[model samples]
Target chain A: MNNMEKIQELRHFLARYDLPQDRPPLTLGHPQADAVLGGGLRPGVLHEVFAGNWSAGGFAVALAILAAGTKPLFWVRPDYEAMEYGAVSPNGLLELGGDPRRLIVVRTRNAADALSASADILGCPHAGAVLLEIGGMPKCLNLVAGRRLAFAANESGVTVVMLREGAQAEPSAALTRWQVSSAPSRADDDDWGNPVFDAALVRHRAGGLGHFLMQWNPEHAVFTTHPGAVVAAPAHRPAYPQERRAV
Target chain B: MPRLPTDRLIRRNGAPSKAPLVVSGKSGNALHVHALEARAARLGLYKGQPLANARAMVQPLAIVPADEKADAALLEAIADWCDRFTPLVSLDAPDGLFLDITGAAHLFGGEAAMLAHVTGLIAKQGFAVRGAIAGTSLAAHALARFAPAIVPAGGEAAAIAPLPITALECDDKTLRALRHAGLKTVGMVAERLHSELSERLGKSFVTRLRVMLGAEEQPLTPRRALPDLMAERHFAEPVVTQDAIAAALLGLAQALSEILEREGRGARLLEAVFFRADGKVERIAIKTGEPLRDPKIIMRLLNQKLDALADPLDPGFGFDLVRLEALLAEETRPATISFDHDENARRQIGFLVDRLSVRFGYTRVQRFVPQDTHIPEAASAAVPAQDRDFGPETWTLKRCPDDPPRRPLRLLQKPENIEAGFPLAPDGPPKFFRWRQCQHDVARAEGPERVAMEWWRNPGLTRDYFRVETKAGQRFWIYRDGLHVQDQLAPRWYLQGVFA
Candidate 1:
């Protein structure tokens, strides 16, 4: 009976040092998508986003903004990536409902430098997430390197998003793998409207696969399924409309 | 040694010639002997003798052209090695050095012992060495050439009296004039009237003589600025293992941290110097974002730099001395335990930025600052994070809420030319376009948003921009140059960026 009491006391002491297991995941606000992802995108793990075309880079940026919340986001990219896929414009990020001031960019000389920088950034629990963009299958980003990155993220509770462009899918330690491409705008809607993407979940370690036609609402900062998913809150409708105006 | 050019050549080649070797250089229209080996000097090949004449004097002679660049580099390196002894070491070009050991003499014993120790160590490296300590640099320069003797204070006049006038190291013309005047020694020149000597030579020459005799002091300009604080270790036997070097660094860092803690300050720029046993020195330096005093942090930064070096540190013949110096020390605010999570997180992020900057570069780790300009590319600027003067100005996005992003998610370094046809409706976006070897039919378009260039700063034609989405849903931002009638040229279109 005395030993049991001591064991209980030790367990209480160790709980403070361990990571908080009750931290809620980030919800994308789309009911169906949230249900498939087991509530939302989990933190403290690695995720991979494969760009089906050049336009898919936008999908990766949107995900990062959602995961980062009010914290800072660190982006690491190689030197050649800027020339090939263009530079990340902070002005554009602001239009996508992200605070440009919260972004930090680390431009590395090569893929190896980018990997090393990502590891260092992930070790800091203060950082919200890291976006690492690599164009090709560099030898430095093999399975071992991926595992190391995953370990760092899990240890610090900093989400990592690896955006791969122009490369084949390889084995990785990511919790979820996605293939993203831009989708045609709805014909009846306004020509100039929010961005839409056809995202397919090819691999999920904890759940099943899914294909989503998600539309990003910049004003509300949430994703909405187009066509026949659900009736969204009207932009013109005031809140508590059923209550009559006293004036 | 006076024959540094010849010595440097022999040491680098690693093999000596069977015949005597000499370094030659062009003097006027003829080749003259710059320096020669000991054997050549003994065979009566004096410097300044014509190379042609030396060949006739000695049947077997090996001659090499003088390389003053390599010789100067070697002299500079030797001066770097001497830095371990004292911080104040100056270059005496061609073949000599000036070491001002005023208060440093007692550290290596007395004046005489220090001189003996220095000359002995240099001699072991296969080079002839001579050193002396005096009250002034000029007095010591004259004494070192004559012999390795330490002159007593206030006895310079009597001690330099018997030395030849060549000890002054004056121009050849002055030496010739003195020789012709029947004054071969310094004492004979000192006996003459000051006015008479001044009238013959110049006021500067008289000053030189006075300084050499200890009547005045000539200051020596040191090679580097003195460090704010320093710690060093000298090994009795050369140390070659990595563990030993690391242990030495750890001890030195601890010593430095204790010193810094007492003063309530930290170092911003730290330098580590390694002195090899064979007269080679390597200096590695690191810069921090904030004043840092922790020994562990300093060790980690140094380890990162050493690992990333392109050419790894070479411990040839092992290292005899290692030194850690704080080049720039600054007062730091005492760190208080933070109760707020956000503040603690910010501090930790600042440290991460410093480490990344050291690995890549300061310019590579950057944060975006809003620029007060309307030009697309000039709207925002990326500056090094360490600079930390970010203005409170926020990015003013152009698009309205709930509308598509008018700006592109990613912008090319510069606009690229594209092939497109004129729209059916005038002053509108192109109907069809070809880009990157793919043809796209425009399904929707928005714009003709006219943007004028900054006429006063960089005058150019105005551009009409359009946001177009293809049938495949890929969006592009394209702009047409000024009207063909106004610019008197063909209307051209360019792809500026891509929208997500």
Candidate 2:
């Protein structure tokens, strides 16, 4: 057969085996980020949102995207994460536009239970999305577990976000991997202005990657693009001195 | 309807043997026979006889302690198993079951065939029982225990006429009184004048006599509520495969849905029972958030429940009958023909929650419900998300978006202790605080919102909270546990929450 005919035949074969078309992407509401992601982050697939520094910025960004959906969300974390790193604050989450009433917090004894719960939550169509916060990726969440999570998420058409802390981007079955760190707010007065995050599209299954500075506007209830700064060699270090140390 | 009675169920729970066995228990100071096997009874060994006397009369008699709990549990399990024959099964106390198979006997061919089937099933399970069918439970019970025969329709009086006076289940005093009066058999009692019997034996004897003769009706109280709606199918051949079970469930669901639709009602709770040929019954229950009459949704929920069961639903020796029952129902009106996409979407969400809760335990899924208390920790509670009433009433906040929220989004379930420097003023916020060894210098402070403890509810020290923003732009809600009025008592500060 000619090259064009062979190519056409291959395309049809790929189409037959492609992921289910029922689940579409959930737009992050950030233009630049969405552009980098081709269109938007695909729902019904596992995605990792990690922070080089274990700050609240990464979780804030996750909550911003989660707030756009009308259905309830499940946030599964290890019980120790709550005891040691402080629990989620209802006021803080409310300020971030995440309705605390619509959020279900599941605290498991260990990472394995959290991941299992995450998979369970993903399979629940009632849950618009699920955010799993793990201290780090353990050996138990290997490719097999990832595939199981992916399959469950896809079947239910629910977005699954894994909030990883102090972990490197490891090889797994996740569709996209992001690195978020706290960035300097634009306001000068000490009123705790809008929250900003230096976000990087570290990995993408469909392939284009980029970095951007995103600001969460509580007034507008959306994430707006900020002027990107020249990131340091480590990729997530604070841009200015004042932003370096936040407790 | 048939009723089966046993003197003692203990002998049936443990190992079965043909040898004469007697279960002994201590009555006051004397050890007496609590129950006996059929062979023991044939050998003239009776219950309530002193163990010493029984042993003296019959050497090498098998004796075991009576366990009433175990016997009762076995009886309950058997009653559950009897659900295959009829859903209306009730315990007759001690060791008896009243099964109201009024409309169900024909499913197994006929009443006679169903009785034979039950006796064979119970016998195979190593339980020796005598079952009888009569118009009334009193006659059925009397025939079951005394003669172990079926009393034909309208033959209640004839059935008990030959039974001994002891079959009346009266006290020994009453029996002695009856024997003294020359009434040894029910026939003699039935032949007595009603006025004479009442004057001589008291009103109670007359009542018992009338009940035994079917002149007075006694009702049977079932263990479970009679289902609001039920649909069942009896397989000609036993169905063992998962596909067959699924198909049977779908058929039953369809049948049940039609009934529900016709009644203008919908089911909220449904139970599916798999009655195995070996007399084992396995049941799965599913709950829905809203009234549902769709067979497809019911089937899908059941499928999820069956898959998620910890103990696989084993159709032991294959199931002969499958039944679907709507345990709870609600009045439902036909939906208005509209193009409201949001309603459909919300319905789908509710279905998803129900399905998820079934798979991963209902308690594992939860929703935050706002409570009345002002205490930050007690302001909201996590209740099961699948709770039917988890709606806007418990979650919607009264404050508008423009109004500043008095509470934080995330309040620590337990306030973490933090070391804070003494403020410049008695009610001012701390200048610096150290939490988890990380120091934060407060650059701006909001207020000293003094909240007093509710006096009626274990009143304690009042708290002064402040919304403090650190130099790095992170806001934390810190509170001083006690007031600063006492010089000797220095209030300790704790970080209670954080703001975005």
Top-lDDT candidate index: 1
* Pairs that clash in candidate 1: none
Please give the fraction of native interface contacts (Cα pairs under 8 Å between A and B) kept by each candidate: 0.77, 0.31
Each candidate's DockQ score against the native complex?
0.53, 0.31
Lowest-lDDT window of 10 residues in candidate 1 chain B? B482-491
Q: Name the best candidate (by DockQ).
A: 1
Give the per-residue lDDT digits (tens) of candidate 2, residues B1-500.
11112334433355335446788878898999888776677788887899998898876787878777877777788898887778899998777888998888887798788889998878766677778888788788888888877766778998899999988888888789889998889988889898988897789888888888888887889888788999999988999999999999999999999999999999988999888887677888887877888999999889888976878999877999899999999998786655786666666666766766665667756666667877667666667667744366444443356333345545666788998987877668888999878998887777788878888986877888887767654667889888877473567898887654
Models 1 onward score TM values of 0.87, 0.81
Q: How does model 1 do on interface RMSD, in angstroms?
A: 1.4
Docking class of 2: acceptable
Candidate 1 versus the native: TM-score? Answer: 0.87
**Residue runs of model 1 more than 4 Å from their true location after superposition:** A1-22, A186-190, A228-247, B12-18, B152-225, B389-393, B449-461, B482-489
Tens digit of per-residue lDDT, candidate 1, span A1-247:
6999999988988654333333578898777667777888878778899898876788888888888888888889999999989888989888887778888899999999999999999998988889999988999999889878878888888988999999777878777777887777766554566788877766666665567778887777788887623233332232223211311
